[model samples]
Target: MEFLNHFRNGLVEGEDRDCFEKFLSPHVSMLYKSAIRMCGNPNDAQDLVQETLFCALKSFHQINDPEKSKYWMFSILRNLFLKDIEKTKKRAEIEFDSVCDKLTDRKHPEGDFLRAEVKSNLQEVLGKLDERLKIALVQFYFEGLSYKEISESLNIPIGTVMSRIARAKVYLKRELLRSESMRLEISKYIGDEE
Candidate 1:
């Protein structure tokens, strides 16, 4: 009967709000510190804490075991933090590509031809990506969003994001290697004069 009451009270809508507030409010400082440690910045840590709490509240009804609530909440936070790390990595890759593109298209044309050749090869590789992988990569790397944010924005799973990125890299590697071979042949034809 006591377990039943606890389970029943866990799902109580208005009642749960007060309980959630009382339970979670006391942990805000700890959550924020954990977030900061995971995220490495105060602003991002705050956002992570808020996002974790919001997710917890939205899914609280599904949590029937009050004794396990802390574990469940921490799970949500850990997942978000890991997703944020992947997002940051993707963003860095995208930014590096963007900078390379800009630099290749602008100055540094007369120094080394191998660098230009590599950049062109990479661009060709990028152009060969399928539409879905292309879009996922763009959203993740170019937009600098977490997996959860990308999932919410694109209405796709976090796993799909991971898979798409993996597939994209495979395709890019194949295309880059092929392009490098082609560049070698083309260079022979064009001659290494000027």
Candidate 2:
């Protein structure tokens, strides 16, 4: 928190901070309310709000319109919240001993080669996804965001976020199957989503 304040103050300075504050002050309450809803508890919500303010202050220089500041701040807040969740999740998911053992797996050298080939091809296939579907899928799977977070970040309905990710997965499955080598390799590992 101290680091964040120093970093922000070093960048924002005097006049710029004042101008940015004009855009931020009016919506502080609104931002707090939204943060509380998203975080599900008051303590976490307050921390999220503090982080949001620092982030918004850092990037406030780029804003060309005062009117857009509200949404901009909201976006910053949501992104910070999602990032904090992702960090916590990653830390909790890391099992050092098991991970090292898995990384050095000697059971199937050929399996590792095949997995690498499939992963490479998967990237190619992922690139073939429609833009909107691709965005939702990447955020949900890679960034580990909930459907609600994705919806808010993308400014879409939760249902729409789900639909896009579902469609993207279906499209990826069909495309992977279209490749004979990928199908032969991955089919044994992946079950039907339905």
Candidate 3:
């Protein structure tokens, strides 16, 4: 709520604002999580999510199907991330190690350490993935979009979506498994890649 509220410029008509609140609310957290993973830092991730939400709110009237809004919002996020990368001609400069420090100031249980390690492994693996494969994998696994939704969102055939997702899994597994510190089995979290 605060995130959207901060970005609100008071320019949207009352009715449009209400519509946006209901329409875009469900996908905001998901978008933010994806943005953080893509941007590798909370600050840039928040900016990216804000831009995505603002862009979607302005174009909410163009959305036809409510069920499809999830994919549409993701399309906006992916496009913005890719566009930023293209314009800058480089990946973000933020260091992934800083995320761990920002995640918590006080240590807790062993599970927290394990979770952080897993997240670190994932972020590193995802960073190493080819962009074409990374986008599809994030959409399916992170955003929980169906294969068809990803295909439509990326303007690719369903078969291509399946292939890219499969390829991404292989790359992730290989890289993560290669991490000596990443002893935790990824299968439980990775889902059935087959």
Best by TM-score: 3
Task: Please give, for residues 1-194, the per-residue lDDT of candidate 3 as tens digits.
Answer: 46666665554768766766677777788888778767868888889988888888778878888677877888899899999988986564223454344433335566567657866676766666788798887668656789998998887899999999999878767787776555344444444464
Mind giving the per-residue lDDT tens digits that candidate 1 earns over 1-194? 23223433556677656767655555555556555544546767677777887787778778767555554665577578657656665221111345344434335454245445655665555645554576566556654556775565445789997898779866765564466554454344444432
TM-score of each: 0.38, 0.50, 0.69
Candidate 2 residue spans exceeding 4 A from truth: 1-10, 13-106, 192-194
> For model 1, how big is the CA root-mean-square deviation?
14.1
lDDT of 2 at 97: 31
Clashes of 2: 0
Count clashing residue pairs per candidate. 0, 0, 0
Superposed on all Cα atoms, model 2 deviates from the true structure by an RMSD in Å of: 11.9
Query: What residue pairs clash in candidate 3, if any at all?
Result: none
Candidate 3, superposed: residue stretches over 4 Å from native: 8-13, 92-122, 176-194
Candidates 2 and 3, the one with greater TM-score: 3
Report the C-alpha lDDT of model 2 over 1-194, residue by residue, as the tens digit.
35335534655467656855567766677666666545546667678777887777767778777676876777787667668766774211111232223323347677566555565566566545555576576557645668986776678999999899988988878887887766766555564543
- Evaluate model 2: give its lDDT: 0.64
Clashes of 3: 0
